[model samples]
Target chain A: MPLSSRPVSRRTTLAAAPLLALAGCRWGPAEDGDEPAAEPSNAVPDEQQVKAALQAIADADAFVKDVSADHVGLAEPLAALTALHTAHQALIAKEGDTGTTVRMGTPTRATAALKAVRRRELGLQRTLTKLAGEVSSGELARTLAAMAAGVAQQVALLPETAKDADA
Target chain B: MTGTDALQTTLAAEHAAVWIYGVLGGQTSQSSQPALYDAVTTAYVTHRSRRDQLVRWVRDADEVPVAAEVAYELPNAARTPAELKAIGLQVEQRCAAAYADLVGRTTEDERAWGVNALVESAVRQLDFDGDPTDLPGIDA
Candidate 1:
């Protein structure tokens, strides 16, 4: 088992069981010898939404890495933010998402880059919050909501200039 | 769990949080540790308001709200400001988890309320020197 495949395998096993359990009222027990019911209509859409959300995270991670690399002074301050994106990717990324690559545009000066990152972080928080409510699975919704809250915490601690940027 | 059950569980956590914050606020000094004092006081007031809101929500659903325990056992003696901050962090972490669970088990207005509470608790954790994480309530 390759290291990269670990999260995909975990998600594959964990996803179906919880949806069935949570939607128990809508899905009755299968009769003896009966074929498994058709896949839930919402499952594909939910996966697509999750993929898009994961892509957004990847983009942010790449941007942060680029900025940190260019501005050595920022490496320490942005370390937690990078770790946050990694943790989120682990939880939300699905099969095929591991190899996904996103193009992060050219970086600006350190101060400008930090402000831009802060804006993007806030934008990502909003995206996660909206997706949380839109998802069909309650469990996934909770995870996304928590992710948004996590972003909120980091956003709150950004440099004082970043705060001014928002205003 | 049912939505009602999630609400009751969160109500119970809020009860404990309110009591614990009260104790933490009392232990923190106003003059020497003004910053810690303000954090504890703010948390105390926020938890109290959240507890009251939970009670109203439970009653609105026609379910009996769970009552707070007469006292909650402190995790530590909390004799110093650092210890008090630790307790404050723990309380916010626990409440964040409860709010996350509530978000899953609810919808519409209740779910919105749960999301707001989870966000507030996550930010509050930083005041107590908590490390920011990828998932606030879930990881906590």
Candidate 2:
């Protein structure tokens, strides 16, 4: 699907249009404090949003790791993210899961997945920069506590909008 | 779902679906039932517009879009009025679920569009099924 989602805010829309240019690019947050990343807020979000986002993250991660990755450069991170993606997808759909399926490839799915994961990691590193260090959803301490997930799943590779930061 | 192939396939499905809904919704000339009929018509147009938008996007990206099938395998043989609505509702549900599945596979930006489209389909399905809240499960 062209995914014709409704257009987002002007700020984010301006930032998102040039993503392909940054596909191979890298950036680091400001030193003393990650200025680009938000100072984590202490406010809580709707439980439903958290649950939905968690589930959505699962599926998104799968896309990164599932396909033939023989041509990719990193295997371990890819495999790990693939595992995490599947787990998140299952959780979003509200289903229990088994272990991740390992897809064999020429270059090894691991390398590409790792690079993808690193990109996501860097993205999040800058993103969480804005958030206050300590926060939580509902009565929990943080997203992890709110999620209370057992599976070690990697988060999403791309932000919904470059404007969303970590999400 | 985030794969180039998967996204292209989904875009193709939506293209055909929008066209089919257009013809199916339009063939019925129940103007007397204005509210109901108009709803169907609007859904068809909305989907069709979305289809065109998607096709253009695919072309712009130098991607091959899915071709329309000679004929769709309707969820079932919808003969009577009730059957037509049933089939229509089923198609919408499947479409909704398909998008929901994509919500997981693609980037955040991609998922936002999916969420909107899914909601639009779900609303139409609810109208057809008489229960706007009910939706099919994801194929995970």
Candidate 3:
């Protein structure tokens, strides 16, 4: 018998059957078959950015808590600040989940405290302004921009204290 | 609406802001309060720059920018310093709203521009003793 005419071994055929089956599986339909998964209509794409905004809101709240009556002329601004931060917290919480705990800055003298709060508001506004440009969702972009502007307004409202105090 | 339309809207608001600041500055300058006069002057210049920038943006988009209204409705006569400040704050609030809308309607770089404008106007409102709100531009 010619060498080329030899029959295939039984074990080899069995292995080849499984190999061909495995090759066939590569072209199979997706796990969902013909149907595609439905995307969440209002899912937040940037949860981290949203959390950062929440963190800013929490920091503002902490500053308000740290302030005392000794702050003098800042009483009304501080009170208004508190009201706005509360509203911001509510708005951010509506967008995504936020933790209640926040790292509190050490309390400082009146002037220093107002200045520190103003700096914090400015920082938040800057951050959100940048995020507003980058966020993919239109609604999220609008909200972030508006929040930044609101913080800017708060920064302007902060009392002007001429005297410097030690923190 | 397209980004150009939003920019035009923002340009209109800037026009109003600049005009209102001029009126406020005139009122403040006539009064004995130099400090208020200086503040209004600085704010007036800022609004003027903003209006000019918006005009440039509209021109770059190949659109004819809308002109400022002959007269904007004042919040009141604004004879006193307090009244002037109140009217200034109102102008800022309206400008903020317009910028916020632009932020929503524009894309990428233009959206960022809107964001800065919104922040500027909102902060200006604070100068006039306006209380902070959750959303500066958003109506309650």
Minimal lDDT window, size 10, model 1 chain B? B131-140
Shares of reference contacts reproduced by the candidates, in order, are 0.43, 0.00, 0.52
Residue B71's lDDT within candidate 3 is 84
Quality of candidate 2 docking, DockQ: 0.01
RMSD of each: 8.6, 21.3, 20.5
- What's model 2's lDDT at B136? 24
Top candidate, metric DockQ: 3
DockQ of 1: 0.21
| Between candidates 1 and 3, the TM-score winner | 1
Clashing pairs in 3: none
In terms of docking quality, model 1 is: incorrect
Better of 1 and 2 by TM-score: 1
- The TM-score values for the models, in the order shown, are 0.79, 0.44, 0.71
Q: Show the colliding residue pairs in model 1.
A: none
DockQ scores for all predicted structures: 0.21, 0.01, 0.22
Full candidate order by DockQ, most accurate first = 3, 1, 2
* Tens-place lDDT digits, model 3, residues A1-167: 11122111111111111111110111111112211122248755776776677666676566565563545546666676667666555654543344554445533566777777777677777888888787665556667787777777666656577243211
lDDT of 1 by residue, B28-81 (tens): 899999999999999989989988998999999999998888998887999987
- Better model by lDDT: candidate 1 vs candidate 2: 1
Ranking, TM-score, top scorer first: 1, 3, 2
